[model samples]
Target: MAAACGLTAAATMLPLVLGGGSGDGARPGGRPLAQAPPAKAPGAVPAKAETCTDPEASLQPSSADGPTIDRIKKAGHLVVGVDQNSFRWGYRDPATGRLDGFDIALVRAIAKNILGSESKVTYRAIPTNQRIEALQEGKVDIVVRTMTVNCERIKQAAFSTAYFQAGQQVLAPKGSPITGYNDTLKGRKVCTATGSTAYDALKAKSYGAVFADTATAQRTVPNQLDCLVKLQLGLVDAVVTDNALAAGQAAQDPAVDLKGDPFTTEYYGVATKLGNDDLVRRINQVLVDYRKGGNESPWMKAYRRWLAADLKGITGPPAPKYR
Candidate 1:
């Protein structure tokens, strides 16, 4: 949280020093503090609802029957879990001092569909490894943090239909002897975020790099961007992350380049605590409409704004698939 938003412990405490304001209302300086949106169980269902996934391919509209949706409506906002590091996906924009990126736009769309206002979103910055645990612990209502859906994660949380497609790829400094995910990694000090599939892949030795001896060379960090930082500071030889995120990191520093063709296929999904089928369904509904086809679609507009360049010619909101 502190790292992603660049907020210090003092940043949070400064709020308490200044006296009375409503939840996330005006502070002494009038800037709203990040606060949990006021909420409770709603007496009725929300009349306005929307989604960002392929609507033509989506199931019938979101029933919005879940207790989670009711609680969110009554609270008057949606609490969304997101990333503050991965570029173009969910990083904080320094120019505006606001979290802005592809994933964040999706989160805001969910807030709008459910709460009738995009600004009703309360952002929670979570690290890569903590995304699932945060959802289970109820730290945030739903995690839209570029989390990849996979069998191992399904046991921990319920996921909406796959909303975005990503793949594991290697990132390294430009002009480095390392050309890609190959023999070049035989003895390199590679870095991956703790709890990410990229780290798991390294642990499993799935990249075919034979170790000369049992000296641990893998570095792990809490956020994917930290690995990039390590690379920049000469702490690690390379970073492994989703192509979408790696693209963002590369943009952050032109000296770095996505080192190779993606080595794995993965899907991104909105996740909730296991068995929260209600919340899962509601989020799935958001995905469905958000991807509705056409240049006018919200998803496309956001893509053009943030990711079109990094992703190059790749087309679309990966076809949606339900549980």
Candidate 2:
């Protein structure tokens, strides 16, 4: 029965990526790459919040019991939504027919801690835009995508304390003239996932960059090697994605490199439906316990296994708080 379930899940994923489902929103055809306008440095003060209420403070976890933990316990499984396309964060191995990455490892650890077995996890591969919505609709219990825990996201879902710190960065082919975010690539096309924070940040910087939907961006030349393959083929001058993702790309292909230091550091956190305090608290406890023990925790071991190359020589304390 378990084998059948896994096969069904895998079948569901294949069409989604092969452009056969409603999920494939846009096709990948575009004009030749144009140079993007020079972008200003990223440290400009953010515009004042028009809405006075703090999103984070408003969504604070309560001590009251919530449905998420109860649902997991009753089902005897942990349903985690994650990005299956990201290399270091989450992706499937064709040879092993298994999904693995830093985020997957962490989710497995959470399942083991909560259900006493790692096998109790049911992985749901989710698109970037659907992560929070999936959680809110009860389609998944938790979202462990490389999702940023921002004030805006907190408005919709509760977030675990940060598990990884990342920032916005640019990926360019080797020897590209673009040195950093501030470099002028004016009139040059830059590719970024549609509806992503990287796009938002680049827009905010007034880079006048072009945008491509994520699916389209992934299909262009060299096939899923990295987000910046378009740049390597000169389809676009640059690609903007998370710094961690950029790092992984650089590690894999010496021909591609991350340009400039990352601007605007943000924390990656697990996301759950709004008002699920009991589950949030339980997860928080597990996170706190993991931190106290350093990299000895199961989560850390998993991190090392899947992300050792990206996280090489890096050591740090665990996150300060959970949900």
Q: Which candidate gets the maximum lDDT versus the true structure?
A: 1
RMSD of each: 11.4, 10.0
* Per-prediction TM-score to the true structure, in the order listed: 0.79, 0.75
lDDT of 1 by residue, 170-266 (tens): 8888978776666678767788888887776666553454322225544777777777766877877888777788987777677789875766656
- Model 1: residue 118 alpha-carbon error in angstroms: 0.9
Predicted structure 2, TM vs. truth: 0.75
Off by over 4 Å in 1: 1-61, 206-218
Q: lDDT of each structure?
A: 0.66, 0.61
